[model samples]
Target chain A: MELKGRAHKFGNDVNTDYIISGRHKFKTLDMNELAKYVMEDLDPDFYSKITSGDFIVAGSNFGCGSSREQAPQAIKCAGIGAVLAKSFARIFYRNAINIGLPVVECDTDAISAGDELAVDLSKGIIKNLTQGREIAVKPLPEVMITILNDGGLPAHFRKHGTFNL
Target chain B: MGKTIAEKILSRHSGTETYANEIAVAGLDFVMGQDGTSPLAIRAFNDMGGEKVFDSSKIAMVIDHSAPSPLEGVSALHKLMREFAADKGIKLYDIGCGVCHQLMPEQGHVVSGDLVIGADSHTCSYGAINVFSTGVGSTDLAAGMISGKLWFKVPETFKFQINGKLGRGVYSKDLILYLIGDVTADGATYMAAEYVGEAIDNLSVEARFTISNMAIEMGAKAGLMRADAKTEAWLKAHSDRVSQPVEADPDAVYAKVKEYDASRIGPQVARPHTVDNVSPIEEVEGTLIQQAMLGTCTNGRLEDLIIAAEIVRGKKISPDVRFIVAPSSRQVYLEAMNRGVIQALVEAGAAVVTPGCGPCVGTHNGVPSDGENVISTANRNFKGRMGNNRAFVYLGSPATVAASALNGKITDPRRYVR
Candidate 1:
């Protein structure tokens, strides 16, 4: 499946507290319910029209502070196809991996705002169609790659049933 | 080869002849989660369509974060966590308890030498007991929940060897804030910090916890202390189990080492917008405060209360400033009350709130109005943390916060050190 849309580019250390301030964490349990506040600071209109294919590209240290998983889950549930960042906060990077939201740790210089890119996990490539160029990201290590392929950790566990490794 | 705490634990846990790389992830003994991340994790569980937890009953769960009057999404999230816990027979928790990390050591989940990963960053609070713990996001929680393990890169080590006795008006909060100024926000990024020294040993468990708790604000992976007699004594009072007493080998290698004389450390505060932006209370002297809060997993211990109580004795809170003290736990509140700390605060016009996260996130009580100013002893003073986005937050120690409450402005804590 190809994801296509304008990019939301950000600089380094874009923490969750910055993305959705802790005070604004809605009590609603629904992921779609969280769409109302995604990137509320940068664009209060962010949640209204985040098409299924739009992607969020961050420079580095994305998703820092507070282990609140709502940040990624909200973004994913809001229909963003993937998160492209230079580096990730240790935890959020793992979180996105565990929950099956595609987070690619590639140099974010390849694309700019309004540039459309598609992350092809199966191909280990991000095609920057907007620039008529493409960049490749080192795929997840074999174990994590399998988990991502299985749609994240839970899905992998469900499919394999259990593990001894 | 030098060994950091993260390396020591991971190498030991990974078995000898390990890679000894600080950038590699290691397996964890137990994973922690709370209501804040539990609900979303449960849905991830459902979405994955799983049955049993990936691991045995080695997981710790709590119902903090959105407790004691939650917003819309939070309340429903709490409901789902309970249902998920029951269905999977996961070690679930019910409400009416307190913060997740507070209950961790209380419930005997965070044992010595254990590597723990919690869904919230303050989970670093567990490090007070010699545990290697750090906070991860909900997705990381889901990952650990599914795999029964966590990946941790070995972290660089920063040794904060502090000496000297804490003077009057000086608390662990102040010393730590002073340390943060030197350490800076990203100073210890991806590093494990060891707060060793005479002063730390002299500090109470709550005080040590306060220091270790804020270690994450400096972008640290975890903060550790040598589990000395103080840790032993504190553990005996709280729990009966103690094992894996680890310390740096005398010849242990360190990436960096810092030494501080706590006696010389005075009241420090972080200016608004950044935790690394620290200065003495004297720098921002006379900056009027509209609110003064003394709590959070950071400095909500009994020692913090006593510090505030001593400052407020015979003095009244500024009429224009709302002084709110929310202890980290009910046990802290009870202890403070028995010790007259609560009376000192209340009689001084300070309002005592419940034992939960509020002003820390600016979602609940003590939220300053737009453009107002406040001082707190909590972690992080990011925008809208204690009120409106426009509201200003300055972070100080409990002493600075309490002393400020008396005069309604940032005052030097050293003046009251008598």
Candidate 2:
């Protein structure tokens, strides 16, 4: 699958609380509503600044605190296409994929904010359209690719059996 | 090849030899979801077409995140959980039952070598008692609930061995904070950490729980220790489930081995915004604080309460400070009351609340205002953890929090100990 988007830049250790503060958690469990607050703490104007089909490039250890599924769900529902980080916390990485949110680990320092980029999951290539450069990323495992292709775990489980694993 | 503790446990559960990075389906001894995550898990379960729960007896749900139902929305979520629990016959821990991690082990739902999974990240708390416990998201938890099994990518093991006794005013909280500071937050990502040493062996069960509970902050899948006579005694007293304890082979392969001299460690704290952003108490001392919180699954045990009470028994907290104490579990609350720990804290001007998470998740109770600073015993000082994004949170030992509460500023715990 290929994803193209503008880049939103975040620094190291952008935690869950920063992604969507817990205060906004129970206001509604709806992902779209929660998406309106993604990165609200870090950027109060995040909602107004973000556009659909945009991607985020972050330094190391993005999504570093809490196992809140809302963190990734909010990001995905916020219209961000995928998140490219130097690294992601384990639970966050898993939750993003489970919810069909694409998160790739690659060197993001070279990618600046607002760069238009295209990511190819199967081939592990990211094209910087704005900069005319190509960056390589480690392709996800075949099984993970299958999950992403099916649009997250629920869809994967529906298409396949829940017990297929 | 010799197996690590995680490998040994997973292999036995799966009835197949498992190694690092190998994906396998592991049968669970217990499956859990708290109010914060259960709603999501329930939704996923429905989407995955789950019928009756795979094992009602093995499933557990707790309502501690928004206990007392701070708002109508949370109350409705609680109602939904209650209905689901009643329909499925799953065990439900209602409000005031304490945090899920503390309640699970205290209620005897966990046993050595058992494979447990919870929707909350701190589920690794069970690893303190030598269980193979890890955190999963709602979808993974739903699949486990429906099938009584979940997928795992076996993690490599990091062995931490420490020697010598800790210094005065230092506790397991300090030890863990110091270790995490050294390893950094992502040092153990996707790995299993096994604690072994004279120091760990000498710690009480509650102290062990404190260390393992924060394992998630270090990015470990599970923090493990060898189950010994102490473990056996605790389990026998608390649990009716009988299972032989599992142990790692002496020659087990490990990703790395780290050795430490516990005697050299000092009081520590994880400063605001990042747990890995740690510094010695002396280095960050004298920083002002408006609130001092002492509770949560991490440090709200009876032992922690005792330390807080000891420090503040005769002194009044600074008039400008707000000190709050919430026990980790109902049993702890009852025991603290029976032991007069609660009264002593109250006499020192502490506001003792119900036994639950209590503002640790920024959900309810004692939320800081914008620009306020806090010293807390609970784990995680990430931005907005205490309800306000602009606030600063300093993570410290119960001793440090208690001392700082009295001073109205960050103070080294050692001064009050004597």
Q: What is the per-residue lDDT of model 2 for residues B1-418, given as tens digits with 9 covering 90 to 100?
A: 9999999999988889999889877899999998888888889888977778889999999999888889988888899899999999999999999999998888999999999999989999888889999988788888888889887888999998989988899999999999999998888988999999999999999899989998888889999988989999999889999866788898899998999999999999899888888998888999999999999989999999999999999789999899999998989999999999999999999998888875898898999999999999988988888888889999999999999999999999899887
Candidate that would win on DockQ: 2
RMSD of each: 3.2, 1.2
Interface RMSD (Å), every candidate = 2.6, 1.3
* lDDT (C-alpha) at residue B24 in model 2: 74
Cα misplacement distance, residue B8 of candidate 1 (Å)? 2.5
Worst 10 residues of 2 chain B by lDDT: B352-361
- Separately for all candidates shown, the number of backbone clashes (residues 3 or more apart, or on different chains) is 12, 0
lDDT of 1 by residue, A41-116 (tens): 5566877767777899888678767777777777888888898888777667767777778888888888898787
